[model samples]
Target: MTEDIKVDKVVDLKGMPCPMPIVKVSKGIKDVEVGQVIEAITTDPGALADFPAWAKTSGNEILKTDQQEGLIKFYIERKA
Candidate 1:
């Protein structure tokens, strides 16, 4: 299901660490409308925690997450 998610925007935070990945996603989410999707690609493991936490805190929705070989992709939908 996640593999087929359509993305309105793509934010690449590769090589960034810690909060930066989530930070970029935070800004990227704003580029899309509510119900639209943004795909955030990052190399930080922190995103495993940060993304979900941010989605909950910011009232956005994480439609899907894909992780492989240290790469992570977040499919987020703006809810608010």
Candidate 2:
């Protein structure tokens, strides 16, 4: 189940490809406070796996992930 999170920032990478979405998400996460959440919207299919792996290695927390139509949304909380 996904948590009802309050996102502090939204990084829209909807027409972008693989690495770009991850890159934007990485940068966007820094824009929020340490405990704040950042919502990353991407159309890249690779993001489904990339995000969770990246969040784990980067020490961040992914609160939720939802995929609808062609868009994927990741709610990531900055933990480091």
Q: Which number leads on lDDT?
A: 2
- Give per-candidate clash totals: 0, 0
lDDT of each: 0.88, 0.89
Q: Kindly report which residue pairs in candidate 2 clash with one another.
A: none
| Candidate 1: stretches off by over 4 Å | none
For 25-79, candidate 1 gives per-residue lDDT tens digits of: 8888888889999988998887888889999999999998898898988889999
Model 2 C-alpha lDDT per residue in residues 1-80, reported as the tens digit of each score: 55568888999999997789988888998898899999899999988889889998999999988989999898889999
Residue runs of model 2 more than 4 Å from their true location after superposition: 1-3
lDDT of 1: 0.88
TM-score of 2: 0.93
What is residue 60's positional error in candidate 1, in angstroms?
A: 0.5
TM-score of each: 0.92, 0.93
